[model samples]
Target: MATLIVTLSRLNARRHATAPVAQGSQCRTETIPMPASGDLVANGEEIVELLADADCWVAIGADPDSSLATDGTGTARKLKADVPYTFGIQDGEKVAVEAA
Candidate 1:
């Protein structure tokens, strides 16, 4: 499992909420199960393809050991390792916009 940290402008039922930031945007450090990769990896191509047409733009780093931020929730946050994975999508776009 991979923990994907997401920061949004607001809270929506579509996206799960774990905590909130001062910006009023809800943040969540969720996870995804990509057994193929064997670890948490948010490679631009892979992620973009995985979240096709999603609105939010997430930039995943290659920490391999430590990409997981303290909470991994913000305008720009890296996801943690070893957590369930799930992406929120609505109308062919990522409504859970950590970007849009």
Candidate 2:
């Protein structure tokens, strides 16, 4: 199993009085264990950042399945160990992480 440090943030961007205004909410961070069954990391998040202790796979809005062979072959994206990766997610979308 691979462990991931996941952070979810919501960015509020708008035009206020003809001026561009951008604000970010407090980030929610979690240490998730990625099992063969995969782990759900984000739900309806505006952005997600992930750092894994081991190589893993992530699928936005879908399951990552159980292994690397199946991951990315579908909807999953691969994440290298000890590297930080960020993703922009659509509203109401879900993200799942699985061990590689």
Which candidate leads in lDDT? 2
TM-score of 1: 0.19
- What's model 2's lDDT at 2? 65
Predicted candidate 1 versus true structure: per-residue lDDT over 4-76, tens digit per residue = 2332232233544664222243332233333212232232211221331222234333322222235655333
Tens digits of per-residue lDDT for model 2, 49-74:
77889988776654344345543367
Candidate 1: count of backbone clashes, pairs at least 3 residues apart or interchain? 7
Off by over 4 Å in 1: 10-22, 25-30, 35-92, 95-100
Residue 38 error, candidate 2, Å: 8.0
- By summed lDDT, which 10 consecutive residues of candidate 2 come out lowest? 15-24
Q: What is the TM-score of each candidate against the true structure?
A: 0.19, 0.65
- Among residues 3 or more apart in sequence or in different chains, the pairs in candidate 1 whose N, CA or C atoms overlap within 3 Å are 31-84, 31-85, 32-84, 32-85, 54-94, 55-94, 68-80
